[model samples]
Each structure stands twice: as C-alpha cells, then as structure tokens.
Target: MESTAGRLTRKTAIISGAGSGIGAATAELFAREGASVVVTDKDGSSAASTAERIREEGGVAEPFTADVSDEAAVIELVAFTAQRFGGIDIVQNYASNRSLVPFDVAIAEADLSVWVQQLSVDLLGCVLTAKHALPHMVRAGSGSIVNVSSLGAWLSFESRPAYTTSKAAVIGLSKSLATEYGKQGIRCNVIAPGHIVSAGTENMYSDEQTEVMLDHVSAPRLGRPDDVALAALFLASPESSFINGQVIVVDGGMSAYAPMVPSFRRLAEAT
Candidate 1:
C-alpha cells in the first residue's frame, strides 16, 4: 500500500480536551495527517480511547490527563508532551468547562463562582497552554498555535454572559500572540465554531433552537466535529503559515447575517 503522507508529517501536536467533541476530532485528524499527537483530557479513559482509536488507524498518538483550569496540571501537560515528543510544533487549546445546565444564567442570577470557574477554564486555560508551549515553538523557530473559541464570542445568545465574555477574551489573546510572536516564527490563530453536534449537544437542542440554527447556518445541515477539525488542520499546517492573529469562524455563515434579515426569515419557514 502506498503511504499516506500529510502536511504535518514529522510534526508534534499537543491537543487539550482531546477525549471528546471538537478536541477529540482534532486529535484524530492531526494524527491522521502524520503528526505525533499528544491527546490530553480530564477523563483518562476517554483520552486513552481517543489515542487508541488513532493508533488503530495507523496514526501516532498517546494519551495524557490534565485539567486545563489548573496551572500545575497545564504545566505538567506541556512538559510531558515536550518530553515524549522531543519538541512541540503545534498546540491546540481546545479545553473548556462546558456547563450543560448552568451555562445560560443572567448576571444578576449568577454567582461569583460562575464567573471565576468559567474564566478559569474558558480563558485562563488557553493562556496557560500558550504561555508554556510558546517557548518550545520559539526554540524550533516555527510553530502553529490554534485556540478554540466559540461563535458566542461575537453574537448574543440566550444568557451565557460568562461564556460569551470568556470567548471574547480569547479573540483578544489570539491577536496579541500574533503580534508579539509573529517575528519569532510562531503563528497563533483562533477558531470560532458554530452549532457543532457532539455528545454534549446530542439532546441539548430543542426543536425551536434547531429551527433557528437551520435558518442561521448557510450550510444545509448542522456542523460536525470533522468540520472544525478540518479548519484546525489548516491553521496548524504550513498552508496557513502566513495567516496569523485571525478568527476563523466555522459557523456555516450563521453569524454573517442579522437576526431580522430576509434570508434568515425565509429559511425559518422554508420547511
């Protein structure tokens, strides 16, 4: 059989939250594309499972456990990857504390804990990962860093104040990294995903919300993890070497239109 060479051949990638959802999908994709994938997640079993899946498909991968919210854990995670892989060429910050039930709370109803916890996972986590990973990338003189943000960063939804704020801060961080590290041969980018389907959202969507998504998104169907994975792949590879400090919104054109636009309204009742 002919070998399936890829853009990331011989590269090393460290992906956080790679046990499931977009993180898992990105890890699998990165491995398939020929990078040595370091998959980390809070759930040891899931992380192992993801790595095993990649290995089953003839990809190089290993599992690690880390809580992105904890500085010690994040530091250890990066150190472990550098030790295992010899160096780091790519880093994808895909970790977040995705709250299913208590995510959409108004500020007045939310406690300080909510803000702290959300910022810790959604924002500080990325900072910690990048802070550690950049040194390796700088030494190598070339590296790509991709951070996973959300569409909520730009658009206003129900009532996810904390989530929205944290995501918005991600955009700022991305730009700053691009500016400070561009001269160092390091590239930093952010991915803003739309309504991607995952285990967490398998049953989270209501009928009305589904209709809204269908209308808002330009793509005929909802988003899959593969969709986001493809974007991350581009950002991590040399194909996007010149693209830095940018937000690649993977929303299927959902965020491109206004709520009252005729096109959105047309799709709302097209069925």
Candidate 2:
C-alpha cells in the first residue's frame, strides 16, 4: 500500500455534493490526507455510502443530507459540521444543479424558471455555503474555499445558457471571497473541469461526439473524477497557501486553443 501524506492533518473540511462523482472522489481523497471530513449531499443514502467507505478505509468522515439551494438547510449544515468537527478549516462547494441541463436553452428560448433553478443550486448554493462558513473560517484566522466551476464558463456551448451562466458566476464569487478575506488568512480558488467522466454525466457525449472531443484534448484520455479531485486537494492543502483568487482549469488543454484546429488538421491528414 502506498503511504498517505496527511496533507490536511488537523483540518476539518465540509464537502458539499459529496454523494457521488467529483465530490465523492474529493471527499475520499481529503480523508486519506488526514482531514476530518463532513460529506454532505441532498441524497441521504449516497452521502452515507461515501462516508461509510471513507470510514472503511480507516479515515474519519461523517455524512449529512442537505439541499444546498435552501438557505436554512445550508445554515444548519454548517452549524452541524462545526459542532461535530470542532471548526471549519476548509469547504468544497461542489454541489451543482446539473439536472437542469435539459431545461437550459438558448437565451431566446430559455425558461425563466430554469434560469432561476440553475442559479439557485449552482450559484446561490456556493454563496450560501460561503456566507455561513466564512465566519467560522474568519474566527480561525485561516481557511480555504474550493469552489467547483465548469469549463463551459469560458467556452461557448451550443445551448445550456443557464448552466454556463451560473458556473461563470461562481468564478466571480470565488475571486470576491479571496479579496475580501485574504487579510484574514482565508484563500479561495476555483477548479473548472472539462468533459469529466462522472456520475450522471457518463453518457453526456455520444460516440461521435466523444471522438471529436478527444481530438481537441491534448491528453490521451478524457478527465476522470480523480483528476479534478487532485486539483481540489492541492487548493485545500497548505501547499497552495500563497495561491488565491485564481482559476485553475483542470481540462486536458481542451480550452487552450482554437476549437476547430484539431478538425482542420485531421481533414488535411486525410486529404
């Protein structure tokens, strides 16, 4: 077995949306690194399962069920975490309203409700989490907030206006938090992932779409949940103490250059 580094030793972390995918992966990784983790999600069973697995691995973790969109729920979640784990040293705002993707459409065709719902869970959730957690961190005079955004925030998608807009807002939120809290020792950063293979997003791209995506990516494979999880770990750890108000793109260089270059090269090669 490989030895654990204990990068987060003595730190207590609250990871929202940790029932599955990137959130779950990040929760597990944080535990292994020595943080006492509070794994939370709207799905009670899923949250419990992730916590159970962490415990099975001999790491300290507890599961809580709360909808991040609800301000009351978020307030209670933060209190519970602090009471259970002593204090909040780190917070990973990983919960997002991805189910609204189907309803998310172009601005002209977009439903008002869809935009509201998307922002409630994706953008407002992060705000609520930070709002309730910041005081705890401020009291401690040191903390880290890792908010998960999406590459869609930077790249233009065909549709899903609501999703992209909310994600882009999260980046702005993170930067604001870093600026306001830096003197108090709080650091805030973002992880913008691209085409990650995660729960509920496994079949996001069709076979043909996947091939086109691969051609644009610099890496050999699409991103995995662990790929983003590792990035979260870095921001959460003291290793990035000096890093704040930054956006770390976790894509396989997909957004690095012109999107059509890969297809142009392939066409030339075929000719």
Candidate 3:
C-alpha cells in the first residue's frame, strides 16, 4: 500500500496575525501538514515567539513583523515571503486592530477616527495583503487566499459598528477576488468565525458574560482556536480545490437560529 503524503506538501503559506489565537494555531497546523509557514504579526516579539515554537516542533517557519494596514509593510512582507520560500501558495489574512469594543459606537455617535482606524486594519489590511500576494500566486499558477472575517459581519451589534462594517466588507472583497482570479488558478474564500475562547476574548469578556454567550451556541462548548484552524487547513488544502468564493461560518452553530428563543424556551420549561 502507498502512504499518503501531507495535504500541504510543497506548499508555502503566509499567515498574518499569526502571533496568537486562530492565526497561531493555523500556522502551526499548516507547518505540520507540510507547508513552509511564514508567521507574521504586528508585534515583533510575538511573531518571533510563534516562529520559534514552530521551529522547536520541527516545522519550517519564519517570523516577520508587519503592520498590515501599511501597504509598504505588506509589500515588504510579500516580497520577503516569495524571496525566501521561492513563491507564495497560500495567504491567510488575519491581522486586525485592537478590539474597539470600548470605543466603537453606533454610527450616529461614532467618531471618524474610529471608523478610519478600524477599517484601515480590518478591511484595508486584507486588501493590501491580497493585492501584493496575488501576483506571486498568479505566477505560481495556483494559490489560495483564506480571509478571516467575523460572525459579527452577519449580526447587527448595538456597538462595534466599525468592526461589523469592516468584516462585512471583507466578504464582498473576497467574492470579488474569487470572481476575478478563479480562472487564473487562484481561489479566495472567507472564514467567519464566531466567539472563540482566546486570550483576547478572555480579556474582553467576563466569566458571566462568557456563560451568557455560550448559552446561545448550539454546541456543548464555546469554540477553540483549533476549531477554526482546522477549518482553515481544509480550505487552504487541495481538498478544497473546487471550493471558491465561499464563506465558512465556524461559530458552533451560534448563528443558526434565534439565540434568544432557546434561552426563553428553557426558561419556560423551568417555569
């Protein structure tokens, strides 16, 4: 019997915001699956740490510090990846600005700077990354771009207007890329992840708040970074060759129905 090779064998991937959370997990998993990984982040030290861990685990990885909001930085990052790895096959756009939950407000009350900052990092960053990386993939004759959006893009939030807007825009941007590039052997897709337990999330929500949020999820537990990472792996691999211009929601079925109905039904049952 012949043995199966790793799904990503000979593939080279650049994963932005890979210093932690879903990005970090995806980076590591991609490496294990045989992709040469470029782990990049806005935080230099954090990027180095993630790269070092991948190296320790016997995976090929390199660390680069880049603020994706800056086109020059993204250009440099793409150039470096292609130069160091020979070409780019996969790009996971995951870098995002710090959570603006505290300051983000309804449009009527939102500051111009708030919208600018949020879109610069969340939306424009993905654009810049794709813009610079596309040529490399086109030249390679095949490539995959997996963009990380948010479930917030689908749900209306009383606050976080900027975040939701940016995320929703990502979906549109991805579809456009897929349409333009599919014939060129390039595919683009969006991953809209729901609430996941991560360092950033732990800082953002209290324990009580977490419990309340979990009640809305149909899954027995809240999502983990690996859950989304695994989804990314499949999308980025050859298995998804026919999957393009799609959005995969990895939210543990949180968005499947009216969350309040489930809680209200439980309350009625108890009564």
Best by TM-score: 2
Question: For model 1, what is the error of residue 48's alpha carbon versus the real structure, in angstroms, after optimal superposition?
Answer: 0.9
lDDT of 2 by residue, 1-75 (tens): 232599999999999999999999999999999999999999999999999999999999999999999999999
When superposed on Cα atoms, how far off is each prediction in RMSD?
2.7, 1.4, 2.6
Per-residue lDDT for 213 in model 2?
77
Write model 1 residue lDDT over 1-271, tens digit each, in one string.
1223587999999998899989999999888889999999888899999999999998999899998888899889889989988999999988877672465498888887888988888789889989998999999999998988899898867888988999999999989999999999999999999999887566778889888788678889999998899999999999999999999999898888666796666788796
State each model's CA lDDT, in order: 0.88, 0.92, 0.90
- Residue 60 in candidate 1, Cα distance off native in Å: 0.9
How badly does each model clash, as a count of residue pairs? 0, 0, 0
lDDT comparing candidate 3 with the true structure? 0.90
Instruction: Estimate the lDDT of model 1.
Output: 0.88
Clashes of 2: 0
- Give the clashing pairs for model 2: none
Residue 190 miss distance in model 2 (angstroms)? 0.4
Off by over 4 Å in 3: 1-5
Alpha carbon deviation, residue 1, candidate 3 (Å): 26
